[model samples]
Target: MAKPKLPIPVTLLTGYLGSGKTTLINHVLSNQEGYKCAVIVNDIGEVNIDAELIQKTGVVTQKDDNLVPLSNGCICCTLKVDLINQIAELVKSGKFDYILIEASGICEPLPIAQSIAVLEGDEEEGTPAICRLDNIVTVVDALRMATEFGCGDNLLKDDVDEEDIESLVIQQIEFCSTIILNKVDMVNEEQLGRVKAMIKTLQPKAKIIEANYGKVSVGDILNTNLYNFEETAGSAGWAQAYDKDEDERNEHHDHDEDEHEHHHHHDEDKHEHHHHHHHDGEDHSNCDHEHGHCCHHHHHGDDDEEYGIGTFVYHSRRPFNQEKLQEFVNNWPKGVVRAKGILWFSDKDKRDYLYVFEQAGVQITATENGKWLAAFPKSEQKKYFKEYPDIEEHWDEKYGDREIKLVFIGQHMDKPNIIERLDNCLDD
Candidate 1:
């Protein structure tokens, strides 16, 4: 006889460095109901604030403590084996109904998920039941995310890569079902709008919540099932809008790209062409991109300097020239801190395409695009391709794929110059 499968909901709490993940988890543990919770807090250095906070919740702890701590700090690659063993022990004890794993700020959730996805009954003893992943709620520092798009100061290591920080933040947000934008009190009303808009651009499906010192409701952050593999690959806001079924959306995006390209060319003719266009929009009267002064009124640089943080979207209908794009990416200007989005290159060996996120002048790999053959199951592909067949007869005939889409974030940089360099890389 086999044991019944239990609904073991596991919530993953994660965020960037100094984003107050521990503080949010402490509040969850204190306010949880209708479940016996087992928390596994993975800490990087000496401080285990999440573990300490959960322990103070007066829940029953297994011997050697239920809080499995991985002090080595590389959870993305090395912590899976220990995590599986601890989960097995806890399930066997039958003392917990739900589980929560507080991932280290720098860790990626893919490997941890892969470990849980492969769990089997033979590896365990008493309770050999299937465990389900529930919610992944990311806690964000509103103030920090406003000023710093992706890069963070690493006080621990001397040579910390800023590229790694951007990649990690994007990965965490992409996989999570909900994102909690904590530390709201530190930012003003205008700043809050900017943060929300930025987050909406990065992750459209996520439900963003504002909190100060972990004041968010635990119920809202839990129980969401948002872990589909295909959707996760194209989960960003811009990507989602680009991925819809309607031909009208595609045409609209294409028209938008054409308009943007026209503007880029017009701006190149004379710098005064974009003199009045604000960073957010043209409607705001006080804003001006010509002077490098934003309406946020943060007082960035001196009178002679132009230093304000901003983001913009770039879209292309054709693939890039690989060598030219590489040169452009490597030689980014000084004020530009981060630029990320998907790119299609004609010279790349891999057909699936690539995702690039540049931070502090380093480009880090996010993932390869979805496989053309795997897009639809064999049975469905036969039926679907009949109506909308690819006339190009591509190597992978069934799936339709196209060009570069990027989002640029910079501080006090010349937008016209940036757009010009990037446009030269794309095939005309």
Candidate 2:
């Protein structure tokens, strides 16, 4: 028999909106110091992540083929099976030294951590885990901490349900082995201290680090091998409710203390796709409804949204006047917490091109991505459009395959009004 390999480290990279998860990933991938790693992005978008985007950032490793996107739903809840399967695939591939699972801004980390533990135990779950939960690294936005924590009392008072982002953030802080507070440049010394204090209250166990532009030693976040599933099981307030689900799972069976200790994975062990029925008859895969910052996958078994932050996508086939777009970007709505997408700007000579935009809170960043694929010859469109099928459908004869497509996630959004305002900026 071939010599068996050691367990691969699977790190969970999580954070809230604009907390610098991508920045950290890009930083680590670009400066891997000879250590190869693969990334599994849980994209909060319409389709799987575009491979070209990662290439444009120049962060892909030799194991670029390992770029997997679980865009259907949140892996911690609705898409845990996909998470498990992907873990198995990466482990089997054995091309990467480490694997990073970057969760959405609204995900709670404990259950996700707990789910990974299931793979290691001797169980009927598919493909025995060839990897282990190495670390749970949460990238938090230091600038938003004081504000998020200030609404502490009644905001996320959902009684053990991880419905609100506030509860989710607290859970992330509590469960993580490493907490990275990014964007420290935006806050002063006194404010940073207060942010640190707030994090310490919920997560005394995590090793906290402050970073700007997501710059940090890769050694700090990867290969630490610090996760202990037993400690994870008993640590959080949100996990208490899952305990009851565990009790119900074994309520009919007889078992000893040893069995009891290892029986959590047995809850619906054979049923792979776990889901709770919803009144609207939608699976968690389809219930990505807009709330504000509190969006949770509703059809996930035991997961429901009592509070949700609104998320809206602005699409325009008409090209935006560069001056108007710049003005709007300069005065972006304060309520808009995060926004990103490709935009087509008018001005035939200098400005008639496509641009990729990223907005975190009020900060805006844009980069030219050459012309839209539709602008190229029909012979060349196949290769580019084939790489991203979801975006290809938006092509037009006059405008080619270009327009404005951005997703805004935040509170109290006026979708129709926002669309109208954006429409007013269009030259066509």
Candidate 3:
């Protein structure tokens, strides 16, 4: 019997806007090093300038079948289906040994990785399951590292609804297996070291490679076979922090149960005393037992704390006064690295619209996501409740599903002060 054909290895390249993804792609195409790589370029605009630039290099022509351009949306969100279909077509052709995908700067790597993992081929349909993700490579601008992450500049000047660039950049950094720290020549050694330290804190598992003008060893990125869906998904610092928090909570709960049972067997009075102690242990300032809300403060050890790097989640059911909220975000906050979450506003015009707010360094952006479930007809809302039972469990009669849930990550952030300030903005 004939052996099954091996799947083609695919490498996903992602970075923040203006991080030189196109430059790196040009470098790869210019020096194939005996590998036939099919390149898929994705851009946010209608015109794919990246594709055109690659054509100008004369490494690949406009008519080259290996070059595929996807535009108008990001592959991680709106263009997911399109990306899958494109990959399917590319795999069907059997023309290349490897595939290179240039994800849009704002694209999140997790969803794209997830989509590729589940893609199966049907022999009857003439599409074979002949693609395996090799690795995820993220490029970072060494010079802009401090300014872009620290400043409050909006990533996209025209699109208010675009995802916050700073949050997206951090997300891109956290999820990748390899980081190309490009333009090392632009910064001093101290600045470069700081950039490397920040990247290491965000993602310790990813290997960082310093490069100048998007130049790197071609073998370092291609066919590395480092992409493991499960490992990559959980590799982010934020994800690990959440998982650790959950585990600690479970362990505490289990210990309390054991203590209660032992006390009950010995004496009823002792049982009550132990129960009181358990409640005392549970009364942490960062947690709201009554509301079942927890502001998880991730402890990344003493060294990490010295760097002041930490993360916390802010959740509230009340809507915010639009004017006050805007003013608060405009000022932004010092020492706060990144913040992103869904928001609820009390303004009459925006009351029904759910908003998403993002902040990185000094830059922040808020955009109308869509109507809240409460804004829908009662019957329509009931349908959503039926589909997601948990939605109804958390529903407030006055506010329904509208709530504020923001995650803030940074160095030496005053969590209590920030939370109090946000509370002041609430339209109570």
Superposed on all Cα atoms, the candidates' RMSDs to the truth, in angstroms, are: 10.8, 19.7, 10.3
- What lDDT score goes with residue 313 in model 3? 63
> What's the distance in Å from true for residue 407, model 3?
5.5
Per-residue lDDT tens digits of candidate 3, residues 332-407? 6667776766677888888887776766544577878677777888898777778776556556666676767676
Per-residue CA lDDT of candidate 2, range 274-319, in tens? Answer: 2221123231211111210111111211111122233444555567
What lDDT does model 2 reach?
0.60
Clash totals for all candidate models: 0, 8, 6
TM-score computed on alpha carbons, candidate 3: 0.66
TM-score of each: 0.66, 0.51, 0.66
List the candidate 1 regions with Cα displacement exceeding 4 Å: 1-5, 46-50, 60-65, 120-129, 150-163, 225-233, 244-323, 333-388, 391-419, 426-428
lDDT of each: 0.56, 0.60, 0.71
Range of the 10 consecutive residues with the lowest summed lDDT in candidate 2: 257-266
Q: Residue 219 of candidate 1: its Cα lDDT?
A: 78
Q: Which pairs of residues have clashing backbones in candidate 3?
A: 150-362, 151-362, 151-363, 152-362, 152-363, 308-411
